[model samples]
Target chain A: MEQGLSNALNVLIVGMATVFMILWLVVIIGNLIIRVTNKYWTDEDLKKSAPKSNHPSASKGAVAAIIAAVEIVTNGRGKVTKITKQ
Target chain B: MDIFSKLFEMTAFGIVTYKTVIMWAIAFLLLFLGIKKKYEPLLLVPIGFGVLLANFPGADMGIVAAENIELPDGHYKNLFEIAHDYGILNYLYYALIKTGFLPPIIFMGVGALTDFGPMLRNLKLAFFGAAAQIGIFSVLIVSMLLGFTINEAASLGIIGGADGPTAIYTTIILAPHLLGPIAIAAYSYMALVPVIIPLVANLLMTKKEFKINMKQMDKLYPPKHQIKNIKTVKIVFPIVLGTVVAIFVPSSVPLLGMLLFGNLVKEIGSSTSRLAEAANGPIMNTATIFLGLSVGATMTSEVFLSPKTLGIVVGGFIAFAISIAGGIVAVKVYNLFAKKKINPLVGATGLSAVPMASRVANEVALKHDSNNHILQYCMASNISGVIGSAVAAGVLISLIGG
Candidate 1:
């Protein structure tokens, strides 16, 4: 009984530790892959217009309402060639 | 030979033993559980029917190998005679089961149906799945103290994993003699998780803990920005994980490899739709029937009636209970440091009963608070439990079998 108890203890520790180890590695690697992929591959349209600046309400960042104004002045046909942050 | 004598000889009463009658009763109970109770009917109905067929006096449907056949060198004239003597079920047992083929195929099907997005999203929550394996080790100790051999105890211990394929695979490798009872016990307790997990959770945790709504936990810590283009990571994960596991514990490769391969087929998107459908449908269902029946057929009067079988059944239940507690305990520990508190009940879902365990967790949380939609969160641990059990089985096979 004592020997079995000791062996069982070994299994408990080792088994738990191994599971954690493998999964922890997976977690770390998974995060790394996601991080790397996202870093290199932000979408082109999202990059073209700053999400923070483009919202009509504009409570936070500097507004680029100039893009809408440009479209209106062009009779809804013109693309805003460029906008510089002031 | 009188006509009456021939009639008497053909009757079941003529060859029935007390043990045979007891086996029949057990078979009937399994049938009731499967058909009437609707408990794991896919497996239980077949197993129950197998038990019934095997118990019939003159059917010769039992999975016994041929007896008293001696082989002397290459010139084997009696090979056909030996083949004729073998039971029909024994052929299935040797072909699909004895070589350890069916369980891995079943895992492939399971993998095809699995979605790893949840586990990948919350990697920290996944460790609770590992913690749930504490039940397997605890039962291993008890079984050993009760005089089971180390291999036999290892087989008994894995029943706590709550993943039928893992339990079946481990038992077939370590202690094939105990496979029938272990498989039955594993599946039976899995069906009982709705009752068992809540009892353990209620005992260990307070009512407030059960009501910890993770969906509302964004108040504690702001949710992280969701990552984009996750498909690339999903495709790569199973292959990388499978490689690492196989490299570390080669014995686990067959089961884990097939599982990851199946997932790969599913996630690769549109290219392998036919293969994926076949793997998760017909292949899986066929394997389940053969596997269930062969496992049931192994439970002859002598084997299933033994005291050790009782110990295995009891030990399996304890292992399952302890596993639930272990997951809950791990979640409590995780809650201590994390900025956002998880519903500790999610921990109880960290056994590999898949959507069933996750559904039970969701149901329990909904009972406490209707708006607590933590199914996705609970699924993280549930899927992790599958991999965790496979790894634990591998460790046991390596440590003890070595």
Candidate 2:
């Protein structure tokens, strides 16, 4: 029972870690897209290209990096290379 | 003084402490191999150091007893007297390693972090995992016939699967005596996958088989809907499998249960993060430290320095050879009826070293044709190998450990 509960706890951490990462990514990429494309297009066009969840247009890299770090801890060097290549 | 001098002359090298000297030499060799040559240094280095501490004849409590301490690494209760309170096996292995809990936990983090879409897309790779079991049994039968007790044979047989935990788990059940060599052999061979698999792959496959063109797989990011579905399957698959295996063979409950539980935790996706953390975090770290050290402690002179150890070492090689051959040949046979033919090298991934074996298959496939990408297809074989080896270990434990 302890083992099961411990495992369940780990799953939560992994899920949150993954969400935090994805959220951060959406934010950063959103910002970059808005800033980069604002010069070429308009704010209305940007909204059409990007979906608006709670994640704003900032801190994408931070989340992306954290997710990558957690993955590296769990999976090791092998998958990191495999994912980057993909 | 004259009697002491006479005793010194009677030793192996006419030295009073020849045995201690010999142990120290062995220790130096392990350290050198681990540090200089980089052969399984991560494990061997620590193991080598432990060996040094173990064999140092005067590590005994002799100095404190003031009996005129003369040697090193030998059993002198005066210096290292505390060791007596904890026999090497009890303090190290039974207390830590033999609880049968750590390796499967690691597998959970593996499942969570792992992407199974590759195997899902190509279900045929399961055959390769099945193929690897052939090696396990072949080694088992041979080892038993060769005069090893059933447990030893089972432990030796696991080497073919090229999995460390399964081997360690099997040894703990079947032949705890041989755990030291068996675990070391399994992990050593795993770290040598890049070296060993290629040699075996080169020997087993014909130029034609090696050169075959594998299909291209799509590399689309998993869509949101599909990802959710996979999450459900992953969680359910474990509980169902664990119940079946646990019911059939309670002996395998610790290993099979832990593995599936890890997988389920991974599958649940949102229940709790501690499951993954255990597999990925403190549990793994603590187990690794204790496991490696205990394994090292078990390698005292009496057990490790025997001719039978040679057989255990040889058994590991045989297991690897049989497993790799089983995997490659199974792929070729499966292709005869199937609409699709995969690179035969992927069969080798059935040994279940996780992404490493599968990645090696990808490398071999790429060698034949740069454009070919068989990794996704091969991954099924790899994961199946994981399940296959675990079940195989369970079977051996039931048949033997029971």
Write out the backbone clash pairs for model 1: none
Candidate 1, residues B1-402: lDDT per residue as tens digits?
699898998887788999999999988998899999998999988888888877888877776632333346534324355347656577677678877999999999988999999988877778888888889988888888899988899999998999898999898888888888898899899888889988998899888988998867865675565667577778888988888888877877777889998899988855576688899999999999999888888888877899998898899999999999999998899889887888888899889899898898889888988998889999999998998898888899888877
Clashes of each: 0, 38
> Which one wins on DockQ?
1
Residue A86's lDDT within candidate 2 is 15
Residue B122's lDDT within candidate 1 is 78
Q: What would the per-residue lDDT of candidate 2 be over residues B84-174, giving only the tens digit for each residue?
A: 5444533444445555655565555555455544554444456567677676777766776677765677788788878777788778667
Q: What's the distance in Å from true for residue B141, model 2?
A: 2.0
Give the Å error, residue B193, model 1: 1.1
Task: Indicate the residue-level lDDT of B57 in model 2.
Answer: 52
Candidate 1 lDDT: 0.83
Clashes of 2: 38
Error of 1 at B313 (Å): 1.4
